[model samples]
Target: MSEAEAVIRNQSGYINHTAKKDYGPLEFTGRIAGGLRLDLRRRLPLYASDWTDAFKAENFQKSLSSILYLFIAALAPAITFGSRFLDGTNGQFGVLEMIMSTAVSGVIFSTFAGQPLSILGATGPFLAYTLVVYDMAVGADVEFMPFYFWVCMWCSLFTILVAVFDLCALMKHVTMFSEDIFAGLISLIFIIDGVRPIIENFSENKMSLTSAMFEALLFMYTFGLATYLSHFRRTPWLLRPIRNLMANFAVTISLVTASALAAIYSSDTNLRMLSVDADFSPNLVLSDGSKRPWVVNPMGIERSFPAWAIAYAILPAIGFAVLGYLDQNLTSVIVNRFVRGALTLPVCAVLGLPLSVASTVPSITHVISLTTYEVKQLPEGERKVPSKVVEQRATNFLIHVLIGCALFLAPALKFLPRAVLQGVFFYMGIASLTGNNLFDRLFLWLIWDPAKYPQYHYIQKLPIRRVHLYTLVQVVCLGILYGLKAIKETSVVFPFFMASLAIIRKAMRFLFTQEELELLDSLPAEEEDGKGLSPEQPDLVNLEKSKENDEGEPAKATMGV
Candidate 1:
């Protein structure tokens, strides 16, 4: 058994993760052009097929369900981030801009991009950048919008150059190590934001204990019920069709049920409701406190504002571009399993919308909602492996269309309680962490008994100590990113800090062997039937048989089989 274990540990590197392509370096224009040509060559063939596959009869139900799931998933963040923008930009941008940006960018990306599954919305880093830029404008005593306009123009220009130069190919250096850390940061942010309300409510002592507890209960109900229903497909209680329906519309069902209860008991509960603008209009407040027009006038500025400031805008734009490119491409790589195109940042600037970058948690949620899985009986129990993804544009198109339609539904949305939405945020944060490998490794720290370990591919291939070390490194990096986020002055360089994760991951090569790094840092590989079961199953079976022999009875055990 010991010999077998050693062999498995030494030889099982590639089993757990997908192989990353080494793009080397694009040292010259020739290489850049070639990369771009290759990208176009691969993508152009799929364009027509992408559209045709979107509207199939069988796709409608799944797409419809995804629309509902993604709408709330996307909306909570849009509104949350929009509120932050309002405070940070002093009402120059708010929920209206976020909604419009998400609605417009989402529709366009779904219809035109090579990959439609990756959702684009306002992100925390971009919000941080906006806040920092606003502070800079204030310090200069200049008009905010005009300075913002030049920054956007320059940022957009840089983003275009990135795409044109095929710079996204550099994402090859970003292994699962950095990806998981980045993902964990985003997930933690969602969780923190969700929990913030409860902290504030209790800390302020504004509400009675009963009312506070009642509000907290509503929050828990939305999160708890939604989470439970999402996993209903795995339960044995219901028929397959019913379980599927419940699972697909889990979030929607939970939100509606919770919101209804909150509304009915609103007078008794006195819970805070979603605050929305009275009308669907521009959120940008002018110098005299009047709302600006829908379009941001690029030329509007203080008389003393210098033309030199326009060129100076490139300094900040560099950071925004790097952040935008990384945000857009990293999520794109994860969603598509290959890098896809992104040029929406420029449009965001033109429209005075929040820079629409790929939102990690929401994008992950969208992909998971559309994915199909198959349950196979293993030695221990039934396990679901991804079978196919419903990669259609119709779902995305309709999702944003609903968001656009939501603009006019302000009256209807007003009654929805903040607690319910925060519950969704909590659920999203928790859900996003579910399949993450970093979380998987960190979970091992609590297992004191080595025998209790699940036979995950990584566990079977590497020492527990080494796995913990890798996880610790990731945690340290995440802490740094979080720290950068916490400090306002440092937040302007937030994207640059995020980009540094790739460098941090590269430094891991000195501490671990090449094979060990593969198991620890690579993306999970797909399970195929003829590929002789996953690396964990055979070991699980052998362990079960060994236990049976040792005890002279049937082994009642399955360890992540």
Candidate 2:
């Protein structure tokens, strides 16, 4: 046989068994989606015959898992933060509202739209800004949350526009380094934001930063121990359906147990117990002209500007436009990376003015958080991304449809607790960090004596002495930011400025020695294989995949088969 047919025949054999057990192989129906149907369909296989049904199933599973993931990523931090908000403001949402809200925006964004697996919901910056705004708006006669909801609706509309236009390709210029910096920016926010309250409450709440951190650490250990015991006992084994989605149920179990203990011990020892609710009564946001239960009509007064503020608005608008563009497209590009569904920058842009209004959280700031998912489940015989990536399109569509249904039912969701969701947020924050490559890279640079942790050597080209200099710069800068963030107003400025420093540093790269430039260039040249995990590294460690075989982008996209 010729080379082409040999490859095709092998791929065909591969797809038949993998895509679905009952399915024989991929065959085109001779009809396309654009209302073109031909009876004598050739049943021509995919461009790559190695596609399989089992692989498709795996992708579907990953998409489904995202629903649970989004629910958790959002609520875990939210529950804790919400409790703190109530402690600060004295309101309650019960467990239901807190949990539902976490899933609400995520469900609407993921389900109604193409980016089902994108995993949207509350972000730290948005929450920070919201609390500040909500507090400020309370003093004014005008509504607060109605404006927030209006902003979300606007952003959602913009997202729809992006999906229609298919402008996601504009994201090609965003690099891995840029993405990492943005993610670091978010994580830095988490640590600092999380720290501020802990420090302040240290005296009034009778807590210390070290003690709270220790309590958080203890909570981690408790969950770890519980997980180990659960696995060790093997009682949950009979629960197979839930077992496949163990992480989903894990937050519920851990937080409940932790809260039980906190409640019991809280009164005696002054352990901070989480608040149970997040008050969502339509306050100033909807009080005026409160006609429909949840709708508002803004009297079309020309959106005004103060004489002093009017001049400043345009420059900030330009700045907002730049940051908004960077944030949304960067997020869209990353979303498209893991998710099979198409993501468009225009979607973010369409949502742009709304995001600026509702919550001007930068899009690129998303990469700061991360999650790891299996891209494809390789068959026993076949290898590479050819397996799951084959039936990617159909599976993605199905998953989004399912998530949409869930979102439509989101308001009725019952039984989840606020603390549990907070635990989920805590878990997601920790889980997303799993995708970060920096911690180990830095550890290697600082502590590892070069002889060990060779992977660090590959990632950062500087020598041991130079590694110390790099570590010193990072530590000192991060320490200063951590300290200054306590002042509240100063926090946002530091991160934006810190990120700006990177631009300056990149420009300064030109001043380096030719040899230093060569060394700097050597980093990240080793590309990841399109495959999910490398076989060489057993425990989710990524390896350099052969460059030739990198999947160009989403297997299913505007490019078409």
Candidate 2 similarity to native, TM-score: 0.55
Can you write out model 2's per-residue Cα lDDT over 1-561, one digit (the tens) per residue?
Answer: 124544654665633422332211122222221111110011233223322431454344443443334333333444454443443333312223333343333433433332222434334444444444334334433343333333333433443333333334334444443544444545655544544444454456556555565455445544453344323212445353344234224544566566565545444443444433123332112225332332233321223222333232233233332334345453343222212122222232222111211111211111111122233445432233422222222222333234334434333332333323333334334333334444444566545454555554334555555444443444555556445434545533443444454464465355554454344323343324534334222111111122122331111100000
Query: What is residue 409's positional error in candidate 2, in angstroms?
Result: 12
Where in model 2 is the C-alpha error above 4 Å?
Answer: 1-104, 111-116, 129-174, 195-202, 205-249, 263-293, 296-324, 333-386, 390-437, 445-448, 457-462, 466-486, 489-502, 511-527, 530-561
Cα RMSD, model 1 = 9.9
TM-scores of the candidates are 0.77, 0.55
Candidate of highest TM-score: 1
Stretches of candidate 1 above 4 Å error?
1-34, 45-49, 56-90, 127-144, 204-214, 237-239, 268-271, 287-289, 301-315, 331-343, 360-395, 523-561
Per lDDT, the best of the predicted structures is 1
Superposition-based RMSD of candidate 2 using all C-alpha atoms, in angstroms: 11.7
